[model samples]
Target: MMWTKCLCLLWALSALCAPVNKQRQRMLLISFDGFRWDYDRDVDTPNLDQMAMDGVKAQYITPPYLTITSPTHFTLLTGLYVENHGVIHNMWFNTTTTEKKPYYQTLFVNEWWDNGSLPIWITAQRQGLKAGSLHFPGTSSSYQGEVAMVREVEPILYNYKNETAWRENSDKVMGWFRDQDLDFVSMYFGEPDGTGHRYGPDSPERQEMVKQVDRTVGYIRHLAETHGLTNSLNIIVTADHGMSNVYRNGLVEEITLSAIPGFSFRDIAFHLVDFGPSGMLLPKPGKLETVYSALKGAHPHLHVYKKEDMPEHLHFAKNDRILPIILWADPGYVINGYFPVQFHKGEHGFDNQEMDMKPFFRAAGPAFRKNLEVGPFESVNIYPLMCHILGIEPEVNDGHLNATRNMLVTSTGTRGENRSILQNTLTGIAAVAGFLAVVFVVVTSRQILKRKRKDKRSGSVQHLPEEENTKQTGF
Candidate 1:
């Protein structure tokens, strides 16, 4: 009986710590780079609108601070802030080696990626599930010396030509799912981002690109239905960051480093410049104060900060890779260095708290709840939700499942309701065990009392034969 009680306690503990089963069979994660949160509102996105109506939609999803391409996208994959993930900026610069790798050049380098946090695809693969990547950043590189099973790291030039290119990529993604039998897959489309860069966000060209990407969305839906993967697969559509117009009255605001009076561009030991909205300035030996003073109040639109004095909310200043001085441009502004001034019509990599920097998030499939319009959430929380759907345990990350768990549904029920059911089950088991214990004590006491009463009644009158034998012995 003691062993039985111990067994019940052990069972309860096991129930509390049980592993989450795979939420669904397949997940297809798609990214539309620089697709603003409000783009669908301005343009006709019937397919996207229908998906929102049928599944879940977020009003907006805020990217992490330093809202750039590589950092935010990797944050979504790894669930870590830029300071922790080490993709501090789109471009890579090694302070120790004095090596500067351009933004596009770092795409193929393995060391530039492979931050300590594992992306979802790599996590799935490590857990014995097959995974694939189609031009998604960080997927090209190996994690802990292991790569995805099926990967296409071709340059972005090959993938984003026009509407046809998007459709072809969608077809290939579907093929990988159907023919290759992959459990997890990621795909990327460089759209409206490039278009917005060429033409301002409000321009007709950007609107047309929006429509083109919408068509691609519809085509992917058609393929999923045609191949009978609609119900079996969970499709997530999101973006790295949103685009903001940078041109005003036909003039671009370019902040040139050479224009600063006190600082010389030659004195800079390592300079990562020409990237819009944000750049890092490392001064030569004994020139830190001079560089900071030169750029601190030089421009009306540019905001400069010393590494240690950076805003606490940004979570950027703690890393060693961050240069001595950080420069940030206000919305609709640009930052430049010794390089020739070229104006892009639109730009990102600004303060993520701004509305213009927020991105779109929509998802549909068996795992997500239907007809739900969730409020805006941080992009870091996305990693945990993806891990939950894949049924793999997430690594140490800054995200919380509670932030997005309500958007998902499981076979048991909504995740929250399923948790409630488990809690109730454990409670009910405890209640039953407690009641049984009380009943055993009561029944045992009654039996003992009955025996005592019978003995007392017998002791009150001796048997006739026993009395006669006692009298004979006395005589």
Candidate 2:
């Protein structure tokens, strides 16, 4: 009897951790770099509009701070803030040697990425699921000697604006799922970001690019159906960060470090600037105070912070990869170094709190509630959501499963039946455990009473209490 109770207890406990779905649904996570929250508002995005009608759509989703390509994307992959995950910059740098690797080159530098945390791809693969990546950041580099089971890296100077390439990538990824039996795959499209950077977010060129993106979105879903995966695969369409135009044409003075009255680049040991709206300066041993003062009040648009004094919400200052005297510009401003060398009409990497910094989120397919428009959620929460759909235990992550819970639906479920599988499972477990406890108590009490009345004729008095049975539900 003791063993039976123990076995039942163990079984209940194990069931609590079971994955949400009995059959793992395939996941396709797609990122359209620098796709702003409102990109569809002004454009005719019928495909995206239909996606909203067919699946769950967020009003918008917030990206982590350092809102650049690599860091925020890593936040999605790892569910950790930039500082915690340690990919603080898109361009990986070594402050010691002052050797910096450009964004594309950094993709191959294992040491630049594999800092204590692991991305979802590695996590899923390790948990008996096969995973693949198509030009996603952090895909090229191996994690603790394990890379994605399959991956593709774009060539240097690859044209990000190519629509045909996106379709081909989508077809290839679907093939990987059907042919290779892969459970998870992440795809990245470097568009609208490049278009936004070159022509500004408000330019007609960017609007045209957004149309291309919409077409690509519709095309991907069509391929999913053609591949016979529409009923079984879950798709997430999101971006790392959004784009904003760099203010120029005399509306405001550009922020130039060299143009400041007392500031001099000679005082800085190693500096990262002129990249975009965010930068950091490592002052020489004795030059810290002067350097900080020169840049502090130099311009109203420029914001400078000592590493220790950075805002807690940014979650960017703690990492060793970050240099001292970090700085950023107000939206529409870029930090210029010696001269205004960069002439891109648009930029990102601003504070995440800015509306322009937030990206869009859309999810669809078998596992999601249709036509559900959810409110904003942090991008970090996406990792746990993916883990839930994959039916795998999540790694230690900052994301909360409940943050995006309203989006999921079980098989053959309606909008009202959107409660999580784990919730239903636990409810049933509690009822059963309570029943077993009551039965044990009643039986023990009956035996004791009979023993006490042994002096008289042996008689048994029994009462069985009815319980409200709790049933498990499936979606």
- Clash number for each model: 0, 2
Compute the lDDT for candidate 2: 0.88
lDDT of 1 by residue, 191-254 (tens): 7788888887788888888888788878888898998887778888999999888855547545
**Candidate 2 has what TM-score?**
0.84
Model 1 — TM-score against the truth?
0.82
Off by over 4 Å in 1: 1-23, 96-98, 248-253, 410-475
**Model 1: how far is 92 from its true place, Å?**
2.6
Q: Which candidate is the best by TM-score?
A: 2
Show the colliding residue pairs in model 2.
Answer: 410-475, 411-475
Query: lDDT of each structure?
Result: 0.82, 0.88
Q: Estimate each model's TM-score.
A: 0.82, 0.84
